[model samples]
Target chain A: MATSTTRLPRAVDPNTVNGWGVDADPRNDPTYPFRDRSREDGPGMAWQRPPLQEPRVEVLRSIEHSRLPAVVGTSTPPKGLSGMIRRAAFRYSESDWRHWLMLLGADRINVVEGIFEDLARGRIPNIPAEMGARAEWRHNKLGLVRKVAIVAAVSAVAVALLRRRGRDDW
Target chain B: MLAAEYRGPYRMRAGRKRMPRIEHPRDALVRVTRSCICGSDLHLYRGMVPDTRVGMVFGHEFCGIVEEVGPEVEKLKPGDHVLVPFNIACGQCHFCKQGLFGNCHEANAEATAVGGIFGYSHTAGGYDGGQAEYARVPYADVGPTVIPDWMDLDDAVMLTDVVPTGYQAAEMGGIQKGDTVVVFGAGPVGIMAARCAWLFGAGRVIVIDHLHYRLDFARRYCPAEVYDFREIEDMAVFVKKQTDSLGADVCIDAVGGDAAGSALHTLFGKAMKLEAGSAIALHWAINSVKKGGIVSIVGVYGPTGNMIPIGNVLNKGITIRANQASVKRLLPRLIEHVQAGRIDPKALITHRMSLEDVSDGYHIFSAKLDGCIKPVLYPNGGQ
Candidate 1:
């Protein structure tokens, strides 16, 4: 088992962080002094509207909204096979089960794509390590052995049936 | 009005937004004073949560002063300082009547799972969050509680989510006297869960996380036994060894979907977008707990299935209790706990930035930068 010998980052100094004690001063605290309610009375829903944010990335909008809300998430824009499925999913209303189910299906496909991508990169993905199988084997050795045996037996039977079918065709 | 905008995964910006108004008769427009970047918000920020449209304001934990009240508003008037519950529940619903405010039926009629949540995505009922200067709070008479005279503003905001959620995590555990409780993920909720476990009569508390800073913070704040899961070769075995090879009585999954430690779970759950988030912590929790023990989950996962070890759960006879914390239901007892100084919710807050720096706040919190345990935003400018 390869243990992480890399040193973890040391704990940060609170004093060095920005905005560490912004509320420490009693004079600065709006609710301080316990008796004063003066700051609470100063503003009452009056303010200048912020400018609209220009969308830098293709933002996915729900069919329910007439227009886009004031802001949207731009991160992880649709890409790959999963992205195509996500784009299709967005075509339907969110309230529809198809929309959600398609997204779930896309997620599973995305995993397979990721494994293929890993393989394409000349990286042999450690299936057991990734799946925490080593720990599973250590903690539940009997269960792991039973599961492997069942899977092996099923594979052998399926292979034997296919071979028998080929022989019968000949 | 200035507000934090969700630009995309790993992105946030302090942008200009329209000031909110009372759209419903039960609505109260609140001028947000203090808001927080909750750990759950990271799921939405990471684009792991479904229906999290762009342009949504992301904040569920906040406190403010009521600026205007609609005609039907009776319990609260303008100029009242209040802490808002994260769950946007309509108090009249059957679930609410039963004190299950997190599952309020009418709040998010589109979903069968969770009630409406502020600053969460449309799946949580498209309510703009209080990360802005002003927010329209519906069911005004039901959710917002007046901040007590003696409570600090910082402490009041913590009650909105972290404290209550953590307390409820322990409450859901069915923790008994001298039971060894192990909590996974040392985020604020996990830290609070570990702290609250003591309140629930747990004999021992242990918190697991990969971050050194967080583990250090958990040691000081939760004051519980802390370990880096990275250093431990096998988490379940380590946990069992700690518990005299009998396993812990209660295990809490505070990490939820974004849990690390398994390359496979990270690939399938996070990077590949297969499951809501990683179920590694949950798997460990189920595997680490003693037979007939309880596994309490407060960590937020998408309303989808994960690769959970249900077989182990059934074989071990583990009682699994999970939910979005019924914040309103837990608030009363939590308020008392806060007031009594049994828990210092404010000590957990390490960063306080103005609403303009909210993007930085989210960045700091998300990256776990500058040793930030909790980051609060002053939307209407500090205090």
Candidate 2:
């Protein structure tokens, strides 16, 4: 690892940045204008906490939080291979890159799982439509064509190699 | 109440939702007049942000009329027209006192990093956004600013996020007199950043993007030099050549996550999902800046890490500054700028649709169709 000395910039004049002192006028201050300073020392967020929403589905909690927040998103709970990967990811600290990388990887895996699930349910998945390829074709025709060609070429080669391997096995 | 709900990736619908009530003493309910589909909102619509639940309303940029207010709210009253800042900050927090309202400790207390954001998903404290007929704004005294009589309602809505974010992008650059500033991505924020760089005394401003219409728009709007990155072979080389081989003094990575350029980044980040989003713009910024330049990032990235060129940052001795723009801190100045006609935030609005057609709005904006730069939604009706 290349360890470098951290160099802090000299104290900058507040005026150096544009619009730095533009809010100096008390009258123009949006949040608090001419408010008594005494209120600053008082307790913040004094409102009573609302009733927590029932977690109808599995809510993934980060390792950093001691408990689930008062409100948590319950949509698309962990399931399938992607869900397992996500569950494993939650085990690690969110600060760790592995945790995030795992989740991102799970997202892609989830897409594939979704397609498989759709096929299993006797519904032909519109991969192009789902991937927003129609819009891509309209807006970025050349780029979309290039991407499709690449995928086609790669798939063709992969299929040919698989067939050769089957003949060798026989 | 009808609100734009997230069904899944690339899916949105204007659906009937429960009317929001002031749950907290400091909360206020606002009848949304005009809301916008921000570039950052596409991240959630595209299923990039974590914990984006189905049926969650997704909007953070809105201007509205206050329908009701809790007893504790002092600054705003019922029937007041206000532009709500995206960040839901408690005024008394340590960060908020320092004017870093985007990192308020009291709001979004569960996770470390980023304050509460309305309609930005669970990752942003799960506060339902203003894409609805009415939205419950927490910390009413701290965030929403009464729209001045002189300001257009469209302009006030943009200030909630885009204008301030773009301004902060340039501000973070610490641009000195006649310094060369290069901004990546010609989206609304990028165009605004390019324009704001001139405000900070930048001699030359350059914008980079793949889209022709957006580049043309940036050229006309920012009146800065624009380049189609698709035409350029190497972004770093092109930037260096433009700046007499010294490189730009400041490079702003206004494009984050969904940036397309490098095949390696696309393969790993988007296809295989090894990283959060493609850090191509960030890479270009780091590589294209001068040895001791500043790379300011106002672009939205996933909470997780991305593949970055930290080694180049160390070797080049670059100063990297990034954050969710503290909208509250910049609001007063921004309001004045809009009033003075220095920055016309409303000019960016190229498409306007009723809230019922939010799905189509999302499609047009996301697809980059009909030369759509910024699409605004009127929940009640157009003014």
**Chain A TM-score values, per prediction:** 0.61, 0.63
Give per-residue CA lDDT, model 1, range B1-383, as digits (tens).
88877655655666677777666667789999999989999998787887665556889999999999978889999999999999877666445665778876555523446677888875676678989998888778889999999989999999999998898888788766556779999999999998887776665678999898888888877667789998999988997777777788889999899898999999988997767688999999999998888899998887666898899988998888878888887788788777766789999999888887766677667666668889999987745
Best by lDDT: 2
Candidate 1 lDDT, A1-170, residue by residue in tens = 11111122213223332222221222311121133344342333222212233445565555654544332323234567876877788777756667776766665565566567658978665544433344445445776698789999999999999999999999
Candidate 2 ranges with C-alpha deviation above 4 Å: A1-62, A65-91, A97-170
Give the range of the ten consecutive residues with the poorest summed lDDT in model 2 chain B: B105-114
Most TM-score-accurate candidate:
2
User: Residue B346 deviation, candidate 1, in Å?
Assistant: 0.4
TM-score of 1: 0.73
| Model 2 lDDT at residue A95 | 82
Candidate 1 has a DockQ of 0.02
